[model samples]
Target chain A: MPSLFFTRLRQGQRTLPFPDAGPDLPERFRGLPIIDQSLCPSGCDACVEACPTDAIASDDSLAIDLGRCLFCSECSNACPQGAIQFSRQYQLAASRRADLVLKTGQSLQLAHRLADDLHRILGRSLKLRQVSAGGCNGCEADINVLNTVVFDLGRFGIQFVASPRHADGLLVTGPVTRNMSLALEKTYAAVPHPKIVIAVGACAIAGGPFREHPEVLNGAGAILAVDLFIPGCPPHPITILDGLLRLIGKIASPAAAHGEAP
Target chain B: MTISLPSFHNGEPISLASVPLLSIREFREEIIAAAGAGATLTALFGTPAESGRVRLFSVLGDPVAGGLAALSAEVDDAYPCLTVECPQAHWFEREIAEQWRIEPQGHPWLKPIRFQAPYRPPGRTWARLPGVTDFFAVRGPEVHEVAVGPVHAGIIEPGHFRFQCHGERVFHLEISLGYQHRGIEPALVGGPGKRTIHMIETLSGDTSIGHATAYCEAMEGLGGVAVPARAQALRAVALELERLANHTGDLAALAGDVGYLPTAAYCGRIRGDFLNLTAAICGSRFGRGMVRPGGVLFDVDPRLAADLTRRLDNALKDLEDAGRLMWDAPSVQARFQDTGAITAETCAALGLVGPAARACGVERDIRQDFPSGFFRFAQIPISRWSTGDVFARAWVRWLEIQRSGVFVREQLASLPHGAIQTPVGAPRPDHLVVVLTEGWRGAIAHVAITDPNGRFARYKVIDPSFRNWIGLAIAMREQQISDFPLCNKSFNLSYCGHDL
Candidate 1:
């Protein structure tokens, strides 16, 4: 055992490149939301009611505030929207909230019929800033791992930055407890325009199951227009990798919605 | 002739019947005898008595029903020490000495356990004086102390570990906790459907399920409410997921700490996957909201059921391969081996629980001994070893992970179908309920009373970290400075959990 100690001392810094090496993530991992208009229920707007961020709105048909939807999968479960299928493709880089929206009532008919769309990047790096609104620390744990050698997001032109001023993406976690509300809003406001807001935990999504409380803040959508919602109380690192890859346009489909998130 | 004191005036002992009162010296000897005979000392409950000092309520044995015992000791102003016999009484004695100034006589080690800032307000009667270890404070080769945290880099909880080290090797370690105390014990008096459960939920963010489970059991025990078998099975499944989530994350962290990148990342990913499954099943990645007082708050739908049963199968398999690589990986093994080795003797003396105890070869699991609800109907295996080192601990966690994954699968396959929760019946008053749970970290024992209004009269939670902190200090006995993180994580006792 003593001899074994000398040999084992130098095993640090072996990195597994994610995003750049771009490991093939699964289709079932909860990613963003896509609307299935046919399955959209009528007049039952529990999804809208359940949405903590007011990410979903209904007028005979539910319209997912793609920018607001936390992909917490709450709407997917409550939607007259069996309409919300968790999209498997992870690369969802968008400059506007409209890009994240899902229309449940045949609104995407022509858009769906169109050929595959590919957008060009301007060669700018994607910088991410994480703000924990009110998570139980699971998502933060996953985010920390993303910087590790295994899922080093830096390999994919995506970087985790220290400040909102340098970030193009926002990784907001937690269920938005009452105390974290001001900080959450201030953080979103600090990030410049053309930046995408990605709510990572179920707390930031549809407030997850902790929504049973009046004290819990719901998701970050109540404060800003969210671009991508990664459902799961704390999403898988690969699921996170999948989400990051999708934001960079490397993946063509978003992963499935969190089982219950809309 | 009976001597009646002012403090005891008319106060009744902790037990009226089924327990006989023993004089101070005789009681202390009986306790030592019982503890020496392998009767686990469950707790030492202290209450102000007629003796003008606090009386010790020593709960003894691993008997199916708890053993009740009490002893009355006169408060002594001189020679405040009692650790010579009952080693377990060291902390409790010091606590009593500091709080009420009653010294435990003839104790070998006497140190301050609480009231760190010292009794202030220019001192009052029965208050400990401004005291410091002047003997160790002197200059001759006095080990330079390195005070690390109540705040540290990284995301773990807060604890102040004072290291007495000579150069790179550690000589002594003193850990000061409770800085992050949120007064969870006092807050448990909130009425039913009150904010108390939620307060309990936040006691230890990671051990939410364990705390809530223990709370529910205490409620169940007091109310005599029989939860449906479906709820029992669901609780078991949730527990498995909770255990898997924490163990996997901790494993990944240990591998990462040892600088095994692939193993760390892979295990990290698997951890996320398992948490994803937890989120899928119960919505909260940590399974927090899933547990309520009467039963679970929600159910696992078919879609999640499929993902948990199928998709997770692959993740678990991949995780096993990753864990295998991590385990067999020579560097990871050496990184942990003997890094933070606690002696088996210390483990037995302290009566620690969970992986820390298991790593040190003292086998105890509340799930196995004091099974409640689902565990009463389940087979929760206890894995242990005698290496008393970090490597042994990490190995124990990994093995437990395998069993945990299997447990989830087994519970899911045999899941009884029904509503996740039933309407909680009104709590009854005047009942004392005690419930114990083996959390992701260790055993969490909850003791509470139903007030006349069916609300909590007094609720007390004893997290395993309280006992395991002793092991942590013992592990640092002769280790080097750099191995602090290894030792800390090996025990990984929660500061928030214990402080609460």
Candidate 2:
């Protein structure tokens, strides 16, 4: 018991004061991608052609759908002109699906505080029920990580409850597979009214890598009315936390959200 | 004359012509004979052949020799079931039936593993939607059934569990999954396209490094690309880091399940620390983009290497302190020791791999048995425990955690110097490659057969969860129903990995 106490003491205060001061993201960590179309030669479509998920518009002046991007850096690697680069911008949550598609000079419209009534109800203490439809468990893993000591998601009063009945909204992951479509719908139905839905990760936002696969329904937005979208192969835990906090008005500066990297 | 199956080393490509195509009877005998001689059934899948016939390929892995024997037989409608004699072929056969719309005539339990439309529907649809089917039931007046869900009570993937129980004791446990299936296998039958690596990386998200490495190995083999030594070392380092993170998380979850908060809380944070180390090397915590076809995408410079080594040492120390608390606590031991015990014989019969089998005293590890990539040059000793219980599983993981920690440190300290990646070309035509990676959970096997046009004719992925899910079910037999969660965590099988 004494050793346990000592271990706890040694581990000491791990929870980051995130939002107050952003956590230090690794230099190599690929977050919000920056595309400078001006550098692209008129005939050269290297990034567009090299894009795996068709994330980059083929008939384009360089616009990338972050929802469809796996952030594998193949596009960047294939771009001979160094027109595209992934900046270490971890805050990439958007209020609408349209905001996830970033053009050369456009910034993402970060998720806004929930509708006045919903914010008033869930602003302080929002309980979410997570449904992993056809997810690979990547998003789920990071979501679970938020509850760990470092993130301490509970500190923000955002707890993941067991039952949908007890939840105020749904936090969804994965490209909604036909097999899981019914279960996701049922879980959403079980949640009380005034419920908001958040699509987390690339799959949940726009099917990620499995887009247009016959087995998937593209994403949660295909079936449910999604209020928020966090885009990543599996969005980093900090990205997820930032999304939740902003949606609930716990952290409310949309100006400081996208395109900024430390 | 004795019929010999074409054998190849791990990650080595074999021409489709070189593989012997035996008669159905011969193929069946070869499979059963190999199983009898202690060969693990690595993969058994079907591909659409000429004349509307379905060609079935069976891969038998000989762990002792570190070689794989492969043979094929064409089945038009239905053939003799291999599961009757070889229990390990049970899931693979059902998968074939569901995917190719061919039946395993006499499989004791035949059902769609993933409830999706067949890839090649032989004039009809045999597949049903998820959870709309029958489960093996135990009939008795005192027997009451408990069904737990596709949508569970945790922040986990979806799968259903039906426990045929009397009071708290269970008669039998049946697990039906498919909720996470996204037709990844069927969707992969093409050249190494843009979306291929991304799909493989997410095949089993937690085992991203494992599955991705397997796919990359297969591609490297088919494309005849020589990976640089430095990239190999970094990949192995990343792999061990993945193993460290997952095994630590499992131990923490096991502790959390037993209501031991101190260790759980500490290890949980330490798990993130390990994940952060992986993220340090590659952008993603799950090691998604770190591993490419020819080699790794990210390089650990000298300064970064030293920094990672220091961070790893600190995290390992924290894990050791946290783990000690759980092992020393009597309450935690009482809950973990004998609960959900499965015998070594059961483990072998069910073809369990990784720590689950190691916990049962089965000395099988892909790194040690069928070494590939960095594993060929560097080796981690196989960790084992004979108890075959929750405690043994946890202990095996802890032992592995320490060994993997040491391995990662060594690799990081003395990384080989070279280019990070080599240009990989299209896969060679009419070749087949099987790659086995020892994921944190278990062996992740990927088999790719290419077409004449240098595209994928068929792609098969067998996650460790597919082999060990039944092991979890069998472990729950006769145990207290309350211990299901603990037992479930002990195995920690992937639903999507299986469903896919």
Candidate 3:
């Protein structure tokens, strides 16, 4: 017992003050990307060819879909003209699916607030049940981290419950394989009415790299009506927390949270 | 007598024609004899053959000789089962029967393993849904069956577990899993295209670096590409980091299961710190996009290497404290000490790999047995404990965490200087290449066979989970039902890796 107390004292405080202070991400941490269109020469398809998931499309301009991107930064490595660079902004979640697609020179915008009814109901507290359909456990690991001491997602009253009945929403991960499809649907149906479904990670949003596989049903979007889409191969814990906070109208905006001019 | 099966070293490719094909009787005898002579079956599967016959391939790893022997035979429909003689062949024979529609006649317990449709051209399909197979029953008035999950209570992959319990004691536990199958092996048949590496990366997402390195090593062997020393060193560093992170997380999880909160919370945070160190080098926390075919995609410069060394040291300190707390706590020790013990004899018979096998006092590790890449130079001592219980498993992980930390620090201090990557040409036609990587989970085996057109014809990935899941089931027998979570976490088998 003394040892436990001493260990706790030694660990100290590790949680980050997120809304008041921005996250201190690593130097090589690939977050939101910035694409410079003028740098690309005519018919330069190196980035497109380099992408493993076809996240980059080179039509009139280069557009990257975060839902499909693994944030591997292979596109940046393959870009000969210095066209694409990943910025250190960890705020990349969005309320709508289409908003996740970013064209060249477009800055990442904050996710919109939830509906008035949702805000009134779940603004103070939100309970979620995570279902990993065909998840590789990467996303599941990150979701589990949200409950750890550092993140302490419960501090904001966002807790992952054991049963669907206690959850106000469902946090779905993985690329929803055929065998898990029925189980995922049953869990979704078990949630009470007016429940929100938030898709976390690239696999949950756009099937990530397994999009074309015959076994998977693309992602959760194929089965359920998704209210929020958090993107990353497995989105950083900060990204997931930001997405959840935005969905419940806990935080005003990403720009406001970071103290930047909108 | 020695079997006339063609043999090759790790990461060395052999021509498909060079593998001698024996008759059904000879093939069965050779495998049984080889197992009797201390060789273990690494892989056994069937590929489509001409004239509607299925060609079976068997790989036996001779650890003492440090070589792998490959043999094949053409079977029309049914063949004699080797599991009757060599118990390790049980799961492999059942899998071959399911995928090829061939019967391993006279096998004791045969059932659909994954419940997925067979590969095309033969086009056999099972109409039954996943986890719909008949289970082994314990019949008595006191015996009752408790079925749990295709959907579990925890945030984890889906798999069904059926336990026949007598009062509070479990008589037998049957695991039926196919919920996470994504047809990954079949998807790799055509070519090593753009999606191939990505597919390998997500084969078992947590073991991304392990699978990706194995696949790359197999491809490099087939293409005759030499990876730079620097890239090999970097790959080893990433692999060890993966091992460290996972072991730390698992120890914490075990602590959590036993209601030891301080270590659980601290270890969880420390695990993230190690993952963040990986992200400092590459982009993803899982080490994705860092390992490519010819060499690694990212280079760790001196500055970044120093940063990693510092962060790793800090994380290791934290982990040490957390581990000490858990081990020192009598409550944690009591819960973990005697729970879910599997004998070394059972471990060997089931062909269990990784920490689970090591915890049983079986010194079987790919890095030591078949050293390839950087492991060929820098060696890590095999971490083992003989108790074969939850405590032994946790202790083995703690030992590995310290050893891997020392290894990563040493490698980072002497960061090699060279190009990070080289171009890999087309693979050799009609060649078979086997690559074994000691992933965080255990020995991850990737066997790639190329067609005449230099494309992947039959790509087999044997995740350590494939060899270790049965160990978990065996460990649960006659144990308390409430200890299932502790035992399951001790094995920590991957559902999708096995289902695939």
lDDT of 2 by residue, B306-422 (tens): 999999999998888889989999999999999899899989988999999999999999999999988889999999999999999999999999999999999988899889999
lDDT of prediction 3: 0.88
* Candidate 3 local lDDT, residue B310: 88
Candidate 3: segments with Cα more than 4 A from true spot: A254-262, B121-125
lDDT by residue (B1-500, candidate 1, tens digit) is 03211111001112122233556766667667766766555565444444545545555545333332333344335443435666766666655555445556776555654323212123433322212232232123746878764434454444567888887878788776544344344445545543456556656667777888888876665665677787877877877777887788788778777777666676776776776676676545666566776787666666656667996687787777777777777777777887778766777777777888788777777777667778877887888877889988888898898888788887777778776676666766754455677888887767665555777655667777777887888788788888888788777777656655
Best candidate according to lDDT? 2
Worst 10 residues of 3 chain B by lDDT: B119-128
In model 1, which runs have C-alpha deviations exceeding 4 angstroms?
A: A1-262, B1-30, B45-58, B61-84, B92-142, B301-304, B417-419
Docking class of 2: high
lDDT of candidate 2 at residue B373, scale 0 to 100 = 88
Ranking by TM-score: 2, 3, 1
lDDT of 3 by residue, B5-123 (tens): 66689999999998989998988888888888878889999988876899999888998878998999999879889999999999888889888888899999888888777764456
What are the per-model DockQ values?
Answer: 0.08, 0.85, 0.74
**Per-residue lDDT value at A136 in model 1:** 50
On TM-score, the stronger of 2 and 3 is 2
